[model samples]
Target: MLAAIVGRPNVGKSTLFNRLTGTRQAIVDDESGVTRDRVYGEAEWEGRTIPLVDTGGYVPRSDDPFERAIREQAETALADADVILFVVDVTTGLTDVDQEIAQVLRTADAPVMVLANKADNQEREWAASEFYQLGLGEVYPVSGTTKRGVDEMMSALVEALPEETDEETPDRTRISLVGKPNAGKSSLVNATLGFDRAIVTETPGTTRDAVHSVVRYEDQELLLIDTAGMRKTSKTEGVEYYASVRSEQTIRDGDVCILVLDATEEIHKQDLSVLTTVNEHKKGMVIAVNKWDLVPKDGGTMDQFTKYLRQYLGTLDHVPLVYTSAVTKQRVYDLLDTALEVAEKRAQRVQTSDLNDVVQAALRKKHPPSMSSGAFVKIKYATQVRTAPPVFVFFANHPEGVRDSYKRYLEGEIREAFGYDGVPLTLVFKEK
Candidate 1:
């Protein structure tokens, strides 16, 4: 379920990738190796989804050791990919290096799709015809900027997947701090590090790569991945599109995400899109409204903002929210405290005996509600099945009769018993 976009530098490989994935996850520049490492993003082609890797644009290097290492990384991407997108600039005719890539693709077990980008018009499209000589077959001349012939290209690519299968992913608690460009992500990291560890910059996109710093809070060391700024997928427009995809890797890697919103700007569609990525990851999350000092002393702006968040984010009502200014170090310490609290809660393990005690006690006070099936779920016992975003399983007769409201009640009771202030809990129903 992965496709690696490979080509020589400045061929618009990143641009084509960004256009397809609809994210600004990869840093694009006229300079080579601007994308120094592997960048990944979710790619949807013709309703079938897969991860798209924007590798560092390769240069024809059979000799340089550094170039060799980059080539190895690109080869690894090829090995891992379900399909390969070989992008070539229609503006520049194919070179020996392009043929070298073709030879590599011919040797690869994965299917290769030739994309002739920058073919903005029919004349350029005609110019793309020469790429057929590479022998990959059927060069699809398209424009990443204008998006011409993109649909056909995507359809052709989707049909080439081996099978519809979900791969087993690594289990890790991921917490992402996402916001618009220059939204104090680096400053917050500095405040948390208590030094100038993370390089702070006045210009945006300084932290190009996703930097992970492990910190201990309440005796537990947790990985905090500081991701780059994410813009709306629709407005991504070419290579900037890869940034959203690259930033999403942090979200996918985390068990929980802490969205850092700029308090100064009116919450735009882009911020919501970032949150949407967090939700799609299904990780426990908290929102840190950053740069709070800039906000005027309005009577109820905080309340209004909170209301808007809850209303828009819906069903994520349980997610926690905190406001702070990284520059002034206002409430910065509280952010870590809350993060630890949430992490511990996520890692909570409730014993079956303890769960039964709480559930039965609550049930005695208020009987398990009747359901539409005309049978009430008789809970015998409940226990924490897992930790790190704790998941609980309840053994019961007529488990199907259990309703969401009653489940919430049981969750509330458990929280009251354990005082999991910052963690999210998962409840499951099972027949005894």
Candidate 2:
């Protein structure tokens, strides 16, 4: 379920958003109108994942261009939300803007809950009584800064949200197409969808938000997410910054991220930054060098391109790579197949017995690195502790002496034995 955070500017809505989502996705600042776009985040409260949208400040009858844009964006977010979390500043007391917001949400299909923010103390909480004049419903006093009363607020929100059930198939693959702007991510998605689902143009940053499309092609059910081209932090402004954060959120939400790299351009720092996000998220990945039709190719061109990518990707070299052209429709359909392939690998599991056997063989082949202090890492046993970027915990005599090199070697051996290709492995060293 989606909930839109609506209020006048500078009322700590973004602060509340950060508290709820446990992420700094929305740019919080003292300056009013800093958040020019609606930023969506996941808020997990009482085992339920609620999608929260931090909307731009609502200014009624605003003549300013930015304020008008903010209001438009907030309305767009409101249409998608099931609930509206109307925020107000208790310290500043009730104001005309508060009344304007209340009046606007009165006819909304979703219910509005008044949040009297800055109620960090009993005095402020008491001061929030005037908010009753809005007459939407009962006002809940909470501190967005201290997070005081946030649990109660979230609990109230949970009650307001509709109950959810597990309806998604386990095999449904969510593919997030991501990369720098103008890398043809939107074009690729449009081509894959066989229609102009996403707006494609030569202009950078044409896509302002993540466009989601559900398609079933030959038994493969896929959620294709096409997001705006993300520039460097220094280059990003209000809307673009929100887009970048949403891109990261999209990465986390996806099962397998198909990174679309520009074949004509050299691999850039921003491209690597995206790779870092994909790596950090531990999502299964497939790299697609888009616009391959534009690249002059020889027999060894693909090999050289892959070699360069491997040099940069280093440990993540095993991720599947495909040369694709959205315009030519060359290898575009294969993206879904590769994404499903990666998703399958992410769900693959190994038995404790087989994993321990592989561990024993690896340890016998190469002993753990010896520390200069004479302490050596001695493995007692190994187990497959988790899946989804399969984590293996190795209990040892001295976990501190387990060097990174040995961990990589053990991971390689485990991969060789189990064939967990196209999936990142997590190695954990713990003292027995």
Candidate 3:
């Protein structure tokens, strides 16, 4: 179930969103129009995880381009929501903008609940009764900051939502397409799906929200999440900053991420920054050099480009690279296939005997560097502890003495014994 928060400027919609979602995902500030796009989060209430969206302030009619864009985003949220929370300020009473928003909400297909925000005390809570004049049913006086009457409002919200089913498939692979703006992430999605599921334009920040779509390939379901373009925090303003935050959050939630790059442009520092984020999160990743058809290439051009990219990737060299052309649909499906393969590798597990065999072989090939005291650090045994971003734990008498260089050598040996291509490996050294 999806619930959306909507109101005019500075009605504390973002604060309410943060309150409901139990996260500071939405940027809350005293300034009006801080949130200019749709930000998504999941709220856990009454043992259910409900999807919630916080939208920009609703402007009934506006000549300003930003305001118009915000209005469209709010309307889109309303269309997709299962229920709408129309927030109003009890301190200010009803105003012209509130009335205008009410008029718009009245036409929505979903049920609308009026939230009288900022009722921190009993006196202000009494004033919340005035919002009933707006003609929306069930006005609940609550404070997004103080947590007053929030539970009562949530109880009603959960009761009002439709019952959910066990429709979520367990075998589905979620692939998130993330990169900087105008990198053809959306274009690649449209080309792969053969439909315009996402809005495509020359505008750099055209996609502000992470859009999700499901498709079947070879009878296997795949969930494709298209996220907003990530920009440097120093260059982002209020809206773009929050969009970047949402994109990063999407990376953590995805099974595998496809980092799209513009083929015509040389790899930028910002691109490496994104690659590092995926690597640090221990998420499976694939680098897609998009607009491949536009690049002037010879027989060895792709090879040279791959070598250059690997230099930037550094230790993340295991991440697979694919040359794609979204405009021509060149190798788009091949990119998806590669992502699926990476996801499989991410979940691959090694038997304990095989793990120890590889570890023993690695130790025989190269003894670990001696400790500062000139004592040898002995790694007694190793075990495969987890999968899906496979993890291996090594026990030793002096675990802290194991150098990072030695860890890399052990990881290399494990990869040779068992292929974990395009997947991050976590090695944990613990005292026996």
Give the top-scoring candidate (TM-score). Answer: 2
Error in Å for residue 361 of model 3: 8.1
> Residue-wise lDDT of candidate 1 within 150-249, one digit each (tens)?
9899888888878776888434344567777788888888787778767788887676557778766556666777777776544342233445555776
> Clashing pairs in model 3?
none
Tell me, by lDDT, which candidate is best. Answer: 3
Global CA lDDT computed for model 2: 0.83
| TM value for model 3 | 0.72
Q: Candidate 1 at 214: error in angstroms?
A: 4.8
For every candidate, C-alpha RMSD to the true structure in Å: 11.2, 4.0, 5.4
Tell me model 1's lDDT, rounded to 2 decimals.
Answer: 0.75
| lDDT value, candidate 3, whole model | 0.86
TM agreement with the true structure for every prediction: 0.59, 0.82, 0.72
Clashing pairs for model 2 are none
Per-residue lDDT of candidate 3, residues 370-410 (tens digit): 88998889999999889988999999989989999999989
> CA shift at 211, candidate 3, in angstroms?
8.5
